[model samples]
Target: MKLHWSPRSPFVRKVAILLHETGLDAKVERVRSVAAIATPNAAIMVDNPLSQIPTLVLDDGTALYDSPVICEYLDTLHDGPRYFPAAGPARWAALQRQALADGMLAILLIWRQERMKAPGQQLPDWLTAFATKIAASLARLEADAPALANGHDIGHVTIGCLLSYLDYRFADLDWRAGHPALAAWHAAFEQRPSMVATRPDDAQT
Candidate 1:
């Protein structure tokens, strides 16, 4: 399998963490592919029309895309504990958490793009809305922090990645200030071998 990957993408980091947890890191070859919202890469578009990272091309020319689908597909390949619960309330909760985290990530990506624009070209309303949404997301995660200890799932991985991304790109926001419980949870999760190994700063550019 070959993965169209980028070192800095949280979505790609999710897949990388899963690969490590499942002992499948060696099974997939990483191809450094640059995928930007403003300018899509032709290489990635060949595998994923959206030009997204973490696009996995299997041996028989089958392609799996977006982080969630790829991670779930890889989960079936290993015998270890499942990152996705097989069924019941646990599965729904995990999936819901993943959706929240991924939604925040999507907002952060666009917020970042907006930040990159010249000050005069930036929209004030959009900036304010982005900040508001992030704060609300943090509050939701804070409320759900206790449930995070129940099990390590795709939700945990995705949330940890999102918090780390905040530290990586939005340090000025001081996200931990009002979310003590969530911060504490992330502090420990960030130390996992998978998380440490895939740190965006530590990745080779």
Candidate 2:
């Protein structure tokens, strides 16, 4: 399998961490796809209409997209118990965690857009919306960080990526300060080899 990849993107990092955690790193090849957001990447758009990174092209030439879908596909490829439980409350909880993380990413991207444009081009309304969403999301996650009692699950992976992104893009926000349990959870997750390997360099991929 070939992974359409870029190291700077948090979404891409999520998939990379999962592949590494599941012991499938050797089986998958990482090809640095063109930068679609900063620069037009026709090849990626050809494969995926959305022109998103972390698109997985299976051995048979089928392509998968977006971080969540790619991660789910990776989970199925593994044998034994899945990182994502197949039934009941486990699946719902995992999905909820993933959604929260995904929402965090979306808000960060919006903030990035507002920051990147000309100083006078800032979108105030959009910034306010994104900021509110991010604040609420983090508060909830901090208050009740997902439990990882039975080894690492998809929820853990999602939260790990979310926290890592905050550190990478919005370190000044100091998300760890107001939330002690989340801080503790992130401290433990930071020790994992997968998290270490996928740590954001923020120095351009």
Candidate 3:
């Protein structure tokens, strides 16, 4: 297997963490790729039309993309345990949580991309709207924190990566201000072997 990846991508990091947790890291080859709105890598487009990082190409030349789909596919390769709970309320909850976390990532990426443009080309209202969504998303996660368990798989990993990215890229937001439970949970979660092993270079910001 080959993975078109970038160390700085939170989505790529999510997949990296998943591979590590499943003991599948050594099984896949990592091919460095850059992906961004301002500078999209044409090489990646050969495998993924969107030129997205974290695109996995299987042995038969099948390409899996984005984060969630890639994670689900990798989860099936291992038999040790399942990150995606089988059908039931738990499964629905896990999927829901993953969606929310991914949505937050999208909002943050939008915020950063807009700010990267020249000030004259940026829309203050759009930036403000993205900020609002990011804040609301954090508040929602904070509220959903206590129920979080240490053994969580994909759902928990999603939240962990998103919060870490926020801390790394949006420190001015002060997300930990009143989110005690979520902060505490994240503090412990970051120590997991998967996270510790894949911590990106400081330049990831």
Candidate 4:
């Protein structure tokens, strides 16, 4: 399998961590495909019209997109439920947590875009909106941080990646100040071997 990936993408990181957690990392090959909001890579477009990172191309010429789908596929390859829930409320909760993490990633990406603009190009109102979204999302997550088990789940995988990206790209944001619970959860998640292995590269930032 070939994976179109970027080291710094939280979504990509989610998929990569899932593969490792499922012991499927060795089966996949990483190929860097830069397809940002502005520039779409032709190589990725050939396989995935969306030109999204973490796009997986299977040996049988099948393609998959988004972190959720990729992770679910990995879960099936392994015996027992590891990266995802098998049934009932646990499944719903896992999906819900994944959504929250993805939403947070979107907010952070928006924040990054606003920060990247020239001093005069930056929009205060836009950033304020993004910050507000971040605060609300974090508050919701902090209120009920998922209890992670020994094996990786979608909730743990996504949350870990989200917190790592926040640390790497939004270090000055002080996400820990107003969201103590969220900060504590992230601190605990950081100690996991999966997180330690997937820490963001400083050079990528």
State which candidate has the highest lDDT: 1
**lDDT by residue (tens digit), candidate 4, 85-137:** 88888888888889988988988887899899998999999988998888888
Residue pairs with colliding backbones in model 4 are none
- lDDT string, candidate 2, 87-198, tens digits: 8988888888888888888779769878778868888888788878888988888766646544567878988888888888888889888888889889988899999998
Which residue ranges in model 2 land beyond 4 Å of their true spot? 146-151
The TM-score between candidate 3 and the true structure equals 0.95
- Cα lDDT of all candidates, in order? 0.94, 0.84, 0.89, 0.82
The candidate 1 region of ten consecutive residues with least summed lDDT is: 196-205
Residue pairs clashing in model 1 are: none
C-alpha RMSD of candidate 4: 2.0
Candidate 1 residues 1-205, lDDT tens each?
A: 9999889999999999999999999999999998877898999888899987889999998899989999999999999999999999999999999999999999999999899899999999999999999999999999999888889999999999999999999999999998999999999999999999899965466
Residue 138 of model 2 has an lDDT of: 84
Best by TM-score: 1
Show pairs that collide, candidate 2: none
How many clashes in each candidate?
A: 0, 0, 0, 0
Q: What TM-score do all the candidates reach, one by one? A: 0.97, 0.93, 0.95, 0.92
**How do all the candidates rank in terms of TM-score, highest first?**
1, 3, 2, 4
